[model samples]
Target: MPIHNADIAAIFEEIADLLEIQDANPFRVRAYRNAARTIGEYGREVAGLLANGEKLPKLPGIGADLAAKIEEIATTGRCRFLEQLRSQLPPTITQLLHIPGLGPKRVKMLYDSLQVQTLDQLARAAQAGRIRELPGFGEKTERAILEAIRAHASQERRYSIALATQYAEALIAHLRRAPGVKQAVVAGSYRRAKETVGDLDILVTARQGRPVMEHLMTYDEIADVLSHGDTRSSVVLRSGIQVDVRVLPPESYGAALHYFTGSKPHNIAIRKLGQERGLKINEYGVFRGDERIAGETEESVFAAVGLPWIPPELREDRGEIEAARAGRLPKLVELKDLRGDLHVHSKASDGRHGLRELAEEARRRGFQYLAITDHSPRLAVTHGLDAKRLSRQMDEIDRLNEELEDIRLLKGIEVDILEDGSLDLPDDVLGRLDLVVAAVHSHFNLPREQQTTRILRAMDHPHFTLLAHPSGREIGGRPPMDVDMERIIRHARERGCYLELNAQPERLDLTDLYCQMAKAEGVLVAIDSDAHTLLDFDHLRFGIGQARRGWLTAKDVLNTRTINTLLPLLKRTM
Candidate 1:
């Protein structure tokens, strides 16, 4: 079986989790975690490189020992160290880490004190009121744990769009290689660019069905095949992502794509329009009293119902059909529109690359500018910069600007929004920078009113420029902090600051709804890749997908403007 980057990353992540739970050396645990991130986001397949007798390229956190381990996993498909760690503890205890507030330390404490090793065990302890009696956990924390447990139990397993893309793209490319295959595309929610996808729906037009199905069954990563037939097959990948592939004739391909690439409500609305027009629309074809009329292309299907083609991101039955009818559909923002990334980091903080390397990559991406917003002093874990260090960094930026060509680097800091609603860096220091990206690094559990007020107060600072990762939610890891988002969006409009649509896979913050809300209030949304490494810029495509879903056009985004136009806007906010 072939090993992909995600597979290797998962192994390293598990090693880190188990080591942390055992109270192992913090730096050792951190090394594995960092290696996992670097490999996971790497643009090429490490396994493939090794297979071709090519050396693994030098990465930031992967040293000699880690490189050997990567070779071990790539060649043998298992990590012996991880297996040994699993033997030393109840393997299931790692699942406890999935709960929002439960870190490895808390899990270790719970196990040592009460012998709690599973969700059911933890739930029983909480229900019996024993968890509150523990030293660190009180009634409020106990209640939140119980609630998180319930939510975790009820939730369906889903993959982040980034991870799903890896599996989907590889499979589609494989299918396209089969003889007689014409078109292959992944439809459904993945096509709609949802943050999470449950499964994949692939539609292919082929000269013959049997050869395509045979090629699919031979896919190296297949864990199990659920069904197989002449025209359709269903299989689950080793990563636990289910995929259904259907082979169709060229004539009915478009109608089938439209039907399968759907939000159920949107399909119903289109069908209703077909009904009123005395036509029948479905996966097979568009028919008028049993005679097929329009099924050759998606545009023809839409024309049959008297509407223009709708972008897949907007086909959620969210007033898109009506807008298409009125010819008011937006020219949704594309990836090419972005001029630069606003919230980025460097080795001075937690980031991987140096200033010149980051600039070279940004220039290669055709960006006019890239802001280097390293962390402020409050996040000492990241080796965040103090005022004196920040000034020195600013001076460095001035020198780089004089020597660099095409790409200009902006000086900035991701200053923490402190608990008392103050910026972490003093106002005098903040005033000297080109931009100040205010963020909430800690205190994620404050009351709704306090949280909102804290952010609002931070935005009011004279030097505040943009709000980074507004909600501070990690897709499956942490619940979004409780705050009044509407009030925040309106306040950004009033204060002339912008909200970030963070493009990191886990933290696609300022969700589609919030983006729409900001647009309604005449506030620009900066679709930024809060990139810690060079490869992280690829995440901008995910942000663009999210922006289109929110009905954002090029004009609604902050970073779409060139440096000449954007610097003026940043000055107004400052």
Candidate 2:
């Protein structure tokens, strides 16, 4: 089996979890976690690198030993250290870590006290009222664990866009290399750039002699082949994501893409339009009484219905068809439209890179500016900066800006929004920066009313410039906090403040709906990376996807403006 970067990352994460449960050294545990992150986010496949006899690039927190482990997993599809750790622990123990409120320590305590090794065991303990009797696991924590386990059992598995991309892009490349292949593309929600994808729909066009099904079945990552046919096949990857591949003739390529890329409602609406015109539309082509009218391309398919080509991101049947009919579809924001990133960090806080290195990397990516928004002091786990440290970092940013040529560093902070809604740093400190990116790092369980009020109060601060990751969601791991997002957006509009569409894979906060809501409210969003490492800057593309899905245009994005225009907007909040 060909081990993907994600596969290796998963092994490392499992190792980290097991080690943490064993009460291993904290630094050692952190190293494995960090290595997993770097490998998962890396653009290239580790196996490909190894195959080409290239040395893995030195990543932060990845020492020589951890690098060796990565190579082992990449080449052998297994890690010896992880296997050893698993031998010492129950296999189901790691699953406990997936429960939202259960950390390694809590799992360890439960196991020691009640011999809990699985969700079932934990649930029984909680129901028996034994969990609350444990030292750290009180009634509240016990109830939360039960709720998380229930939610986990009920929810369908969904992969984050970033992780799914790693799998989909790799498979697409693999298919393109097959003999007689003409075109290969991933359709469905993956093509639409959804924040989470349920599965992959792959469409391919090939010559008559091609062996597409054979090639797909041979993919190294295939965990099981669900079904196989000459023109269509379905398989499950080792990562648990199901993939369906279909082979079509060149003539029906566009129609097949449209059918597979559908939000079912959107396709139904288009088919109804065809029906009105006395035409039949299906995956193969659009026809008028058995005479094919359009099928070669998506544009033709749309034109057959007297509509323009709707961007795939806007194909949610959410007024997109109407807009297409009226010729008023938005020119959605693209990755290239961004001029800078407003939510970046450096080693001054929890970030991996130094100021100069981050600036050079941003400049290398053609960005004109990058903001260093390190965490404020309340987040002591990250060594977040105090006022004195923030002031010093501001001076450092000014000096670096003068020394650099193309990229300018903006002084900023990802200041914690206190429980009562006050800014982490004082106004005097916040006012000196180019922008202040405020975020709520704690108290995620506050009641909806209290959470909404907390954020609104934070926005009222004189120096508040932007709200970062406004929803505080962690994708599959944690749910969004209970808060009134509409109220928050309205407050932002009134106070001249901005909201952020944080691009980090796990926290693509301010979801597509919220993005649309902000757009409707006349509020501009900063599609920021919230980067903690140099590689994190690449996350902006994910943010752009979320923005496009929300029907955002360049004018609706804040950082799409030049530094001069952005500066005045920031000043207004100050």
Candidate 3:
């Protein structure tokens, strides 16, 4: 890998610390630290120049003095000064730098005060009364330290979709009821209905003028007021959630909406185009020499800039504007396009409803078909089906299909992928079901190389019609298991196995980029809601927008087909 600015700057800083402890030349020590900071804040990667054999000194922060030190370090595995420092302190002490309040100065204090190294040791020393005895430490200080450590350890990798949705719902509802509020919406990444949301953004129009800003701060849940002004205000909620509310004039509502609902890259690209056309873009309005030209609404912002209206999800500035400019945007699929739900549960496994009840509900939603996919036997907690139960579920599906109206029920199983690259359900058992969704429920932390091979092997199994939520990620709780999405999607396409765009907000797997790429590669995707409860069925809207972000259309999705047309694909012979 080429050395990025951060990568080089970090190494340089290490050199500086080592020099201090090594008792090396003073100027040499200062040069490394100074250069490291300068390069780090440069805002771009320097890896590109390394490939071209450009000397380091040519880059910012690399003066002749610093350049010599870099050359010496790169040529030898051991930096002479660093080696000396390594002998004096336990290397693990460096990790204390990761804690927000505990910088190197505080780290040195903790070391001298209690000789603590790792987080566990530090937490213990603080708790055992050694830390609070120090000159600057006290009960409140120790408590803060303890909380920081706990927070760091439990730093959520992602937020659950449900949690984000709840916050958005409350904020939107509250703002809508606020006096003078004409229209309010949860915009930004949340508005796009993303699987994992980072923040909650609220946009509103106010008729009562500047006083509306004061009313917003009155809510009891709002605290840690960040910034409050006429046009904008922000506060951190008690739940550790940040809510940003922007008040817009009704006339500039659309323009303000477009600016706030940003995919930064998309915004950058649009602004670049505006600059080229002698126009300016901002939240106030898109302007020509201070005379407001367009931006009454989001639609006009795009029209003013000579482009078609782009959806919020596609605003990521990731080829979306180009696609819009070319009029080649994918005819995105919608919730109405979904003809059936391919991965659903019933009383056969852990589902709340029974087989007949599930089918009837699907029919009620105007679905032409519904697949009752229960967990296989390995998932014991879910009442996973055995050979006998699988046979019964299939027979029940047949019986129910005979009694149903326009809709038909498909029998399927979500079989576990075993460590040995085999499905939990045997070939004989799998052969009986109309469809099979193979998933990985255990051994999530397997190395990427092994996990990819493992899932690909299961997909190669003739019975696996679809790979369910291939990443196995739950919003904010866990990172996706290390599997190559591009590799897995390609393997499934080659084997004629569909990849599921699981509609569950927490697991909108095969994200927008993967969705578009998969379509380009001729892979058939199933927009399965993976609905467990009746209300969870509403997640279809998020999935549809996600699919459209990937540029999917009704024709590109497998589940959008009528039940009659879907049956043949479920069989092994097809």
Candidate 4:
């Protein structure tokens, strides 16, 4: 089986978890976790690099030992060291780590105290009132753990869009290589750019359906073929992602694409529109009394119903159908419209690269400006900068700007928002920077009103410019902080600050609905790449997708403006 970057990352992550549980060296554990992140976020497949006889690039935090492990896994499809670590721990203890609020340390504590190595074991202990008797876990914590266990069991597995894209694109490429396949593209929520995709709907226009279906079944990554037929096949990939491939005639391609790439509500609304127009629309095509009227293209399908073609991101029945009918659908933001990134990090903080390398990469990407917003001192784990250190970094940024051409590096800090709503850095230091990107780094479980008030107060800071990853979410790992997003958006409007659509795959904060709220409230949202490595600049596309899904236009995005235009805007916030 071909090992993907995600696979390599997963192995490294598992190793880190087991090592942590064993109370291994903290630095060693951190190195593995960081290496896993670098591998997972890398733009290219490490396995492909190895297969092509290339050396692994000097990845941040990845030393010789980790590199060797990556190559071993790539070649042999297993890591013996990880297997060794697994042998020392309860085999199922790692599954406990999947439960929210249960980090490796807590899992270790639970195992030591209650001998609970599985969810069933943990649940039984919790029910027996045994867990509450433990040192740190009280009655409330016990109840929360029990509820989390239940939630974890009932939840259907979903892959982050970034990881799903890796698998789906690889599979699509594999199918397209087959002789009879004319076109193969993934539809459904994947096409819609949903944050997490439950499964993939792949549509292919092929000369022979059987040949394409046969090719799909032969894919090296497939663990099981659920069903197979002339026109359709379903298979489960080793990653646990389910994919259904449908082979359709060329003429029905557009209609089928529309049908499957659905938010069911949107599809139903579109069908209702077709019905009212004396036409029937479905996966086959649009028909008027058994005669095919339109289906060859998405534009044709929409035109048949007296509407323009809707972007997949906007087809969520969130007034998109009405917007199309009125010709008021947004000219959604595109990746190319961005002139800069507002939130990026470098070696001075937890980020991997130096200023010069990051600047060169930004210029290579045609960005006119890139802001370096490393963490504030409050985030000690990131080795965040203090006032003195920030001054030195700002001085370096100034000196580098003089030597650099084409791209300008803006000085900034991702200052933490304290619990009492004060900015982590004092006003004098914050005022010297180009922008201040405030974020909530701790206290995620505050009540809705307290959280809302805290953020609103933080935005009131004189130099506060942008809110990075506003909701403090980690996609699959953590739920969005409970707060009134509407009030936050309105407060940004009131304070003249901006919001961020953080492009990091795991922190695509400001949910789509919240983005729309910001749009409606006249607050400009900066679609920022919150990039840590040079590869991270590529994440802006994911942010752009999220912006489009939120109905954001280039005008609604802060970074869409040129530096000359953007500086004035940033200045106003400061």
Candidate 5:
């Protein structure tokens, strides 16, 4: 029986966090954590289906007890084991599960000795010297925790797929060129083009022994090397990143890559399909008896089981196999078809580059135009513009238009949508800007209904042009506000509002599904990188993937339009 998705995953995640806090086996914790992620990538309501007499743990990581909890979740919508484990502790302690270094052991010790659970309480304890007092926890460890907490607060958790892609490309380039390297490629969530990536994993083909071992020792960014086996290497980068690379023979490259590029559930389904067909698959190629048959590429692996090619991102074993067999794969969007970015900041606010410099950058990227959307006056922290300030910036853009040759700057403002569901500026103020990007700033804890109503009401405001990072999700740590994304997309379409594909790595907010639905419903998609710094600008490639995944075409993006064309569309927003 396949371990039902939710049960096995929940147990694994909790167990990993608990074990980490317990200071137990680091590898065991990592194994469970990785397994949970691999299983969760399968896009289905797993626990629910398992209740209907399904095999549990057929998915990877479904050891007996973990599999049983999946059955529990499927049957009852909750896991008893997780509930029991946390029963004596304050619920807020669970949040520590997310903070990088303080695993289950540290958490338990803090709870037992200090009777503290929430981060606020723990911070106070650390300041008071309670953290250092714990046996085995030194001043250095305590300082590290405090630093991680602060970093955890400021670091963008959700990166745009584009940013992750850049890092992957940078890292892979080096790994591929290492001595004895044959073939190397990125696998895992990055390969699937997920909105956020915790780390990047690359697999390689190489000769065994000293060639691979020596090359492992030469990795530039490895802050700490963890393993150096004959054909496998694991290292932690200076950025707190753990990268695992394995080497295999050229003949096994295809099968090994397939096995390693797992949304574990997807791989399990593929394995099961092979079994049903009297074949087998592993790090070795697909085989029937002693005869090797296929698997040098994912396409061949799938073909062997009578399935069509599935996009790496969609290989979640989420009925993808059945869909492919039925010849019903959804058409995904591509970068070439996307046209422009709707949200951006410049020197008019907190952005580093000035108008001309920014415009030229856009031109280099082959963009037709850029929207000089400085921060609105409400965000004083950003040196946002008042009406007088706004007028001056608009004038500069007007002058730049006459002088600049290639790209044009569209007058725009990233206005704050106040809590009252009204935009920060009055209609008269908004009327002056060529385009308005209405966004929510402060309140993230509003009820789901109220949050939806607030954004919807703002969209109804005639001056609103686009919505940026609609859900306000930051990535791994912050969960997206519980808005009805489907509703937002539908309403935006009917109201003639454009939903932005914020190209910023931290907020690929309008996900592929939302963009797809919007396109279907006649809503325009604006794939903007929302670049703040110069380095951030190149991240548009990942945003292009999101647009492609959402089925966006050049016609869907506003940046694809020449300045002459984009102006009228902004005018229509008013």
Candidate 6:
């Protein structure tokens, strides 16, 4: 089997979890966890580098030891360190970590105190009211564990877009290199840029001698070949994502891509249109009484149905077809349309780079401006800055502005919205910044009314410029806070404040639906990186994906404007 970066990363993550449960050195555990993160986010496959006899790039947090382990796992499809850790602990205990609110410490506590080794055992203990008797596991904790177990049991596994892209791109590259292969493209939700993908559908066109199916089976990453044939094949990658590849004639490639890249309802609706036009559409091609009409390209397929080619991101049966028919399809926001990032962090508050490095990187990326919204003191875990530290950082930013030539660094703070709906820093401190991004750092479990009111109150602050991660969600890990988002969006419009579409893969907050809601209300949304490190700036692409799906255009985004225009709009909030 070919070891994917995700596969190696998963092993390292498991090793870290087991080591933490065994009470290993904190630095040792951190090293493994950080290596996993670095490898998981890395753009290229580590195995490919090793295959070409190239030295692995020195990834962040990966030292010699971790790099050696990555090579070993890539070559052998197993991590001896993880295996050794499993020997010292119950391998099943690692599964407990999947339950929300259960960390390694709590898992260890459950194992030592109650012998809860599996989800079933933990669920039974919680139901029997035994978990509450354990130290730190109160009734609320026990109840939460039960709920998490239920949710986990019922949820289908989905891969994050970043991870999915790693696999999809590697596979596409491999297939394109196959002899006689004319074209290959990843379809389905991966092409649609969905936040999470259930699987990948690859459509390809090849000559008679190409044997794409055979080539797929030869891939190094195939963990299990479920089936293989002359024209179709299915396999599960080591990282647990299923891939299905279909070979089609060049004539039908476009129709096949359209058929498979569907949002089910969208495809059904399109087929209905075909029926109304006295045409039949399928993976084969668009036919009028067995006479192939159009299928050579996606545009031809759409044109056959009297509609313009809709962007895949908007093909969610969300009025896209109607818009296409009426020639009103939006020119969706693209990554290049962004003029700057409004929420960025530096070493002043838990970020990895300094002000100069951040500014240089932003300038290198062609951004006209970058906001240094370091965390406020309320988030102590991140060593968030107080007024004194923030003031000093502001002074440094001003000095850098004078030194730097191309990029302007705006002074800002990601101020915490306290439980009582108050801003973390005093008004005097907040008033001095170019922008104030209010966020809820704690108390995620507040009642919907309380959460909504708390956020509204914070937005009412005269200095408040934007709401960061308007919905406090962490994708699969944590659900969005119980807040009335409609009310929040309305209040933001009335207050002249903006909302954020945080680009971090884990927190694509202000979801696609909410982005449309904000747009509908005539409220500008800022697609921000909320970056803690330099590499995080690259995550803006994911935010752009979300915005495009929400039907956002350049005009609907706040950061698309130049600094001069953006400053005036931000001042309107003040």
Q: Which predicted model would earn the best lDDT?
A: 1
Per-residue lDDT of 417 in model 3: 95
In order, candidate lDDTs are 0.94, 0.90, 0.76, 0.92, 0.73, 0.89
Tens digit of per-residue lDDT, candidate 5, span 223-285:
798887877777876545567877777777778777877789999999999999999999879
lDDT of 3 by residue, 221-257 (tens): 6758999898788898755678888888887888778
- Model 6 misplaced regions, further than 4 Å: 19-32, 50-81, 138-140
TM-score preference between candidates 3 and 4, better one: 4
TM-score of 1: 0.98
1-574: candidate 4 lDDT, tens digit per residue: 8999999999998998899888899878888988898898888888889999999998887889999999999888999998898788876898988787887888999988778898999999999999888888899999999999889889899998889988999999998987677778899999999999999999999767988887778899999889999899999999999999999998999999999999899999999989999999999899999999999788999999899999999989999988898989999999999999999999899899999999999999999999999999998889999999999999999999999999999999999999999999888999999999999999999999999999999999899999999999998788889999988898899999999999988988888999999999999999998888888888888998999999999999999999999999999988
**Better TM-score candidate (1, 5):** 1
Candidate 6 lDDT for residue 165: 84
TM-score of 5: 0.69
Q: What is the TM-score of each candidate against the true structure?
A: 0.98, 0.97, 0.72, 0.98, 0.69, 0.94
The alpha-carbon deviation from the true structure for residue 206 of candidate 1, after best TM-score superposition, in angstroms, is: 1.1
> With candidate 3 superimposed using the best TM-score fit, by how many Å does residue 350's alpha carbon deviate from the native?
1.7
Error of 1 at 346 (Å): 0.4
Residue-wise C-alpha lDDT for candidate 1, range 1-574, written one tens digit per residue: 9999999999999999999999999889989998998899999998999999999888997899999999999888999888999898888899999998899999999999889999999999889888898889999999999999999999999999999999999999999998899999999999999999999999999969999999999999999999999899999999999999999998989899999999999999999999999999999899999899998789989999999999999999999999999989999999999999999999999899999999999999999999999999998878899999999999999999999999999999999999988999988899899899989999999999999999999999999999999999999998899999999999999999999999998988889999989999999999999998899999999999999999999999999999999999999988
Candidate 4 to native Cα RMSD, angstroms: 1.1
**Which of candidates 2 and 4 is the stronger one according to lDDT?**
4
RMSD of 6: 2.2
Q: After superposition, how far is residue 327 of candidate 6 from its true place, in Å?
A: 2.1
Candidate 5 CA-lDDT value: 0.73
